[model samples]
Target: MNVLLFGASGMIGQGVLRECLLDDRVESVVAVVRKPLGFTHPKLREVVHEDFTDFSSLAGEFKAVDACFFCLGISSARKSEEEYRRITYDYTLAAARALPSNPSLTFTYVSGEGTDSTESGRSMWARVKGRTENDLLAMPFHAYMFRPGYIQPLHGATSRTRAYRLLYVGVSWLYPLLRRVIPKHVTTTENLGRAMLAVAGAGGAGEHILYSPEINRLAAEGR
Candidate 1:
């Protein structure tokens, strides 16, 4: 399978890339990024473009892809709602618009928990994420949304926020404890990555929304 991947440099994206590379079924990977990903492989191709809004600039280059994993996301802290919306909502729609060429493409979105798209007057971040999720679901591609909470890393770290870094650090030591006490919403990066690839390869059961427990389950099954 050929995959069109975004946010290959980010944490979740890195895990996804690793899983894709390791999977023998994946024939080729086209990764889109703002800057060069600084890696090369026989099966991997990188496209450096700063603006997601103008994906059509490379529309002709958008070839047949079996799936698209949109892992690009930014923290809600230190940004206004409008700015957050542009990144979370606008950029997502931009990518979706370009994937119609890849008929029967499976789209996996990294959405957060507590997302509410009814234009509800609750948290701005959740509302934006919810709206983005809803909008992407409306697209033609077979879509799946992953709403994971407190994603712990598998190998390397790529969090831009210091607070997130700290949280990951704490999670490393407290994962066992948290697993015992935490609800099913929280999941680690390794599990999430494994689940995503499994779901993508097997095809989803309807428009699936995989919460943390489902992710962990799939990851376990994939292994």
Candidate 2:
């Protein structure tokens, strides 16, 4: 199977790319980026395109993809609601519209915990994410939203956001405890990646949304 990956330079995308490259079932991986990712592998290909809002120029490259891992996201830190929606909702929808739709084609979206599916929530970011997830689900292609909380990066996976990286460093020691005590609330990058691959390949465990425990379970099944 072949795959299209967005945000391969980000934390979650990095882990997914690593898993896809290592998996024998994946024949190729096309990573969409604004610039070269500097990583090299036989199965990995990078497509540098600056515009995420308009995929018209890149339509030719977005065809017949068996799976798409949409990990592109940005923190809502200081941005206005419009700015955040542009990145979180508009960019995701543009890519989804560009991708070819099929029953066998799976699209995995990496949302975070507390995402409000109702789209009428108090949290601005969650509402945007909820709307994004809701629209993706309405599409013809198979779609799954992964809502991971406290993701412990494994195998050199690091966040592109400096603040998140610093926070990860500060709380790195609590990963083991969280995994043991609150497995449903915590999952490592490795497990999340494997779980995505599993669902994309097998089309299960994605009735609607997936939390951390379900992700770990799917990963174990895939393994």
Candidate 3:
């Protein structure tokens, strides 16, 4: 399978990219980024593009793509709604629109656990994410929304956000206990990556929106 990946430098993206590279079924990975990932693999191809709102020039890269892992996102903390919406909604929609209208294409989006599907919610991020999810589901491709809560970054994957990094550092030792206590609310980067691949390869089954428990189950099934 040929894959197109966004936010390959991010923590979740890093895990997905690693899994894609390791999977024998994956032929190649085209990662779109503003800067190089600095990590090289024979199957990895990096495309440096500055503007996420417009992807017209990168049309060639979108051709013949079997799956797209849209992991690009930003924390809403300390940012205006407009800024968050631009990155979350606008960039995602632009990429979706840029891809060819193929039903065979599997488009997986990484949303948070509390994302609103109704497009109307008390939380600003949830509402925007809901609208994005709703719009993507309406698209022609086989779209899947993954909502993972309390993700444990495995295999050296780390968040770029300082606060998130600190939080992970403080909570890393408690992950095992947390998983045992609340397995449904927790997942790992490895599990999330494998789950995406499993859903894509299966042509999307069960539910369009998968929570952490479903994500973990899919990962195990894939293995």
Q: Candidate 3's residue-wise lDDT over 1-223, tens digit each?
A: 9999998999999999999999988999999999999978999999999999999999999997999999999999987999999999999999999998788899999999999988777999999999999999999989999999999999999999999999999999999999999999999999989988998898756698999999999999888
Which residue pairs clash within candidate 2? Answer: none
C-alpha positional error of residue 50 in candidate 3 after TM-score superposition, expressed in Å: 0.3
Summarize candidate 1's per-residue lDDT along 122-143 as a digit string, tens digits.
7999899888888878787678
Could you tell me how far off, in angstroms, the CA of residue 111 lies in candidate 1 after the best superposition?
0.5
**Considering lDDT, which of the candidate structures 1 and 2 is the better prediction for this target?**
2
Candidate number that wins on lDDT, 1 or 3:
3
Q: Estimated TM-score per prediction?
A: 0.93, 0.97, 0.98
Ranking by TM-score: 3, 2, 1
In TM-score terms, candidate 1 sits at 0.93
- lDDT score at residue 201, model 1, on the 0-100 scale: 77
Predicted candidate 2 versus true structure: per-residue lDDT over 79-193, tens digit per residue: 8999999999999999999986576789999999999999998999999999999999989878999999889999999999899999999999988888889878998889888
